[model samples]
Target: MKNLILTTAALALGAGMAMADTVRMGTEGAYPPYNFINDAGEIDGFEREVGDELCKRAQLECEWVKNDWDSIIPNLVSGNYDTIIAGMSITAERDEVIDFTQDYYPPTASAYVATSADADVTGGVVAAQTATIQAGHVAESGATLVEFATPEETIAAVRNGEADAVLADRDYLVPLVEESNGELVFVGDPVPLGGGVGMGLRESDAELRGKFDAAITSMKEDGTLNEMLKKWFGEDTATYAPDGSVVTN
Candidate 1:
């Protein structure tokens, strides 16, 4: 595993070398737009919607499972889930452990700050999950590290100053910061990271890879995917894709 990732932003998930059709997808539904737990207690979000579309296009039964971000990849590797749909960056390092699909959504990396005040938090030591590319970025920043299993816990780490900041995704922090974590903020223009979320299958399921990829491409052509992006990130949706077709909100 080097550092293979989907670059752009607004995505979740690393792929497995193999693929599967009846996918038991994993996500941190707490991260909105990309993946979230709805009021009905059902897993829902951009990636969830995307998964549903893939199931329809590929004619497979798909189930979504919510897991802590820290455990997503491990859980997938353990066979707890079939593929990951959460906004996971497909980095080269991760590619050693898992393979990827053609990027449907891109990857985003950003800094977390206090909502009450603006501070230049970039280029410093920050807190993040272990093994994630964000952790690598934080390591490179030359700041202290506070590793946690969930982004929520990492936010708490910032509030307590255990960490100077949190290096996370832009989409993951918006609703989190807006809902009252007044001392927390998201800083910096998003630093684009690696690959987008894809269907991760056991190394034995290559057949399903073709099906999942086709589903993703079909969603892009039909506009449902972009519409979901707009609903979540608005004009900033441009960061979600490498192509330049986003209609500014």
Candidate 2:
């Protein structure tokens, strides 16, 4: 759901890479609750906890690598990192270039936030993080779409009146709206987007992908994944059912 379109050459390069012993987990360390830098400046968030646990369950030695959101996929394909555990949604457009494990997080909605509850989200300017599904949706929704390099910048655009509203993942925006003290309010209905978030791997890394997929399955079956989802995204967050199926509103 985020990052640039991959080039054919990049995809070919990714397909030719050899497997390594240590799985380098790549992420954009800026999106809070999903992935972010904590106060002590180390990468810490829902993804870090989940990635660590997945690596443990898979019996793999993993290390974290922080990258800018815009270049995350390109860097992964170029061998800068082994897998992308960023808050990246699984979409057909993205799956064309890289392989994805079974979704670790359930499908969630994209929502709009503005200073006013009745903001003109449909026809007015809407800001979204660059190369995201929300940005693509805004572009095709008869609205003025403004793209930013980062999620924080999209919210800033709404606050500064550069855009009428900012559309982003509901999980990411919920805490901001609550902490805004009436400065920021939700406008318009939440739009369901993407399949779900998954770990991205090179197309040639089928064995690696299978390891992560199995680990994710175990987490879902045992309810650990649901517990992590609630811990980071609030108790009302969507989760896996008893049968290991995603249960979303």
RMSD in Å for all candidates: 5.7, 1.8
Across residues 53-149, which tens digit of lDDT does each residue of candidate 2 receive? 9999999999999999878888888888999998898888788888899888888888999999889998999999887888888988999999999
Give me the candidate number with maximum lDDT.
2
Candidate 2 residue spans exceeding 4 A from truth: 1-11, 14-17
Query: How displaced is residue 219 in candidate 2, in Å?
Result: 0.8
Clashing pairs in 2: none
* lDDT digits (tens) for residues 1-249 of candidate 1: 112132332224444434444577777786666777789999987788778888889888877788776556667666777777776665555666665676666544464565334553554447776556776766666666667766677788777767777777766777777876465666656666555555555444457667787877777777767776677666565533324233333
State the lDDT at 28 in candidate 1.
Answer: 76
